[model samples]
Target: MRPETEADLADMIASASGPICVRGGGTRGVHLDGAVLETGGLSGITLYEPGSLTLVARAGTPLAEIEAALDAEGQRLAFEPMDHRGLLGTSGAPTIGGVVSANVSGPRRVSVGACRDFMLGVRYVDGTGTLVKNGGRVMKNVTGYDLVKLMSGSWGTLGVLTEVSLKVLPKPETAAGVLIDGLSDVDAVQAMAKALGSPFEVSGAAHIPRGLNGQPVTMLRIEGFAGSVAYRADQIASLFGGMSVRVERDPETVAKGWAWVRDVDTFQGTEGDVWRVSCTPSDAAGLGAKMKLAALLYDWGGGLIWARVPEGTDLRTRLGAFDGHATLVRGAGQAKFQPEPAPVAALSRGLRARFDPKGILNTGLMG
Candidate 1:
């Protein structure tokens, strides 16, 4: 089932007797045991204001289409949403709905925000077969409940989004990367935290073990005017004096490198279990140290750790105590999402019941 408009989506939802799998671009999702409802037919940009840095588009609009439109206006999605096809081994153009539904964000997320932060408004068809709208095109249009944030990262459990409004940012004049070589994971975490703490305005920070010439490479990114970028690069090098530092000014190469980290590219092609762990920057190294058998890629100045562990290894049990959580991005044995605590689990169930009394939308996708 594919909906071409809001009315069509509502009608389809109302008539459905059982659970339905919601698909957007079909790029990212777990397998579901229900009739598939594709959103690709509901596509196109509704509004774009380059001057205001706002864009409104139907949910099924291709992500590439939105990016091209923003690029033409010298603007971009500040969240730098990631493309999951590479890591998931799925072949489909990513869609705006999928980006929002998954709340995808790249390396720049540490600086700006995630997909939910940029989302201004949304129009979705709820499980009750009623059309619900929240927020608006402008930044200050939050008049009531912030349903925009709720729909995001909901995995289509609450509702099926039909359209979305987003806030964009102007592209930086230039970007430069400071590469510090030969730092161990512990030292790399400390260095990245220091760089992020300083006033140098580091926008992206990542460490790849055995990623560069068989040695650990710590990368710090800064974006701004050419002169500002040059000065910051030098200052960063001075701060980490003992290490080998190289500044990359080429935008293409710098983008490719960050994209690799953002999309978990290192874990690509290798057939192994991948886990994403989020914890305090100071504790990332300690947490990673426990996973001696896993390959690691650190992002967000050590706040986000991507691990390629052996299949069937239960991460939550192995890494006993931690400040944050670990999510199984791709694996066969363990559950995809961490189990929410009892209180939080109850709240989640309550929300799901309120929004989806029939529970006909993407049933069991979140579990």
Candidate 2:
């Protein structure tokens, strides 16, 4: 089922009799048994204001279109959303609604924020076929319920988003990456924490235990004016005086390198189940050590761990209890998301009941 208009979408949901699988771009590797509701029919950019640093696009508007428009104005989506096509091997144009639905933020998320942070407004259809619009096209909109945020990262379980308004940032004049080699996972986390804490403004930090060349590399990114970028890179490199640090100043090289980290390209085509682990930065190395995975990639300065283990491995069982959560990003036979605490689980159930009384939207996808 595909609806081209907001009213049509609402009506379609209202009339649906069975479970519905909400899909946008078809790139997230989500599979479920239900009637497919494709949002691709609702496409196009509705508004864009370079001076105001804002953009509004329909849910199915191709992500590339938005980025190209933003680039023409020397602006960009500050959250640095990841492209799942390479990692998931899905062939479809990513859409703005998909990004918002998944709250897909990339490496710069450590410094800027997640996709939800920049969201200004959203228009979606709830389970009962009601059209809901919350927030607005401004940064300081504080009217009623903050449903704009609630819709984000909801994975379309609550509603199907029709349009979204976002805040954008000016593109940097230049960017550089400082690469530190030969550091163990523990040492890499420590170095990343130090770099992030420094006043030099590191925008991206990641560690690949095994990179394209089959060597360990810790990357730190700085962006701004050319002179500022170069100065900050030198300062950050100097912080690790005795370590092997190489500064990459070429704009294209820096962008490509960070894209690699943002998309978890290290494990893109590799064999095994992939897990996305979120924990306190200081506890990352300990958790990784416990898992003893086949490969590892650290992002967000160690706050996020991507582990590749043998297929059908239940990583949460091996790690025992910790102050973090492990999510299965690839492979099956186990739950994908970590089980919420009792209190949180109750609250989640309550919200779902309230939003989707019929429980027809993307049923059982989250679990």
Candidate 3:
């Protein structure tokens, strides 16, 4: 069921008997066996306000197109949403609706926020064939239930998003990186935490494991006007005095390095099951030490850990002791997401029932 308009989609859902799998470019790679509803036909940007740093676009609008439009205005989606095509091994086009539905964000998420933070508004069709609208085109348009936040990460189970409004930010004038060499995993995590606590406003931080590439490297990023960026870079380098410190001032080099960490570029080619684990930064050092048996990297100042474990490894059982959740981003594993607690699971089921009375939307995708 390909919908060219929201009305068309609502009518189709009104008549659907069996389950329906909603797709935005279909790059999510979650194999849902049911009638597929493609959203590519409902494309195009509806509005762009550079002065206000706001953007409204159809849900099916290509993410790349929105980025290009933002780039032209020296602005961007501050959350820095990631592109998962490489990791998922799928060639389907990525759409803005998909990014919002999945709540995808990149390295800078450590500083700014996730996709939900930037989502100001959304228009979707609930499972019972009801056209629902929540939020508005501006951040101050707060009037009712914050369903926009709820829909951001619902993965199209509660509703089918037809449009979205996001809060964008001006691009940084310049950027630089302070790279510390030869730090052990534990030491690297501490160093990143220190940098994040400083007044320089570190925008990105990650550690490349020594086991993976011979020498461990800790990277800290600062972005702003040229003078401020240079001053902060030097200040951060001075903070790491006596260590093997290198400042990357070249814009291209800085971008390339961060992009590598943001997209998990190195692991894209590795043949193994990849897991995205989120935990408190204080717990990251311990978790990394325990997971030393596998290939790993730390992002979000050690809060987000991306690990590549051997195939058929039961991650939930292996990581049951940890407080955070582990998501299987790749491989045909037993589960792709962490199981919710009993109470939370009950609430989720109840909410699904209210939004989708017939249970006709992406059944079992969350479990």
Provide the lowest-lDDT 10-residue window in model 2: 84-93
Q: Sorted by lDDT, highest first, which candidate order results?
A: 2, 1, 3
Index of the highest-TM-score prediction: 2
- Model 3, residue pairs in steric clash: none
lDDT of 1: 0.91
Regions of model 1 farther than 4 Å from truth = none
TM of each candidate vs. truth: 0.98, 0.98, 0.98
- Please provide, for model 3 over 1-367, each residue's C-alpha lDDT reduced to its tens digit, 9 standing for 90 to 100: 7889989999999899999999998776877878998889889999998998899999999999999999999998888888888877788788999999999999999999899999899999999899999999888888999999999999999999999999999999999999999998888999999999999999999998853467889999999999999999999999988899999999789998988888788788779899999999889888877765778889999999998889878877877667789888988847888999999999999999999998988889997
Q: Write the per-residue lDDT of candidate 2 for residues 1-367, one digit (tens) a residue.
A: 9999999999999998899999998998788888999999999999999999999999999999999999999999999999988777788889999999999999999999999999999999999999999999998997989999999999999999999999999999999999999999999999999999999999999998888788999999999999999999999999999999999999899999998888888888878898999999999999989888458999999999999999988799989999989988888899888999999889988989999999999898775
Residue 74's lDDT within candidate 2 is: 99
Q: For candidate 1, lDDT tens digit of each residue in 198-279?
A: 8999999999988847889999999989999999988987898877889898978888899888898888888888899989
The numbered model that scores best in lDDT is 2
TM-score of 1: 0.98
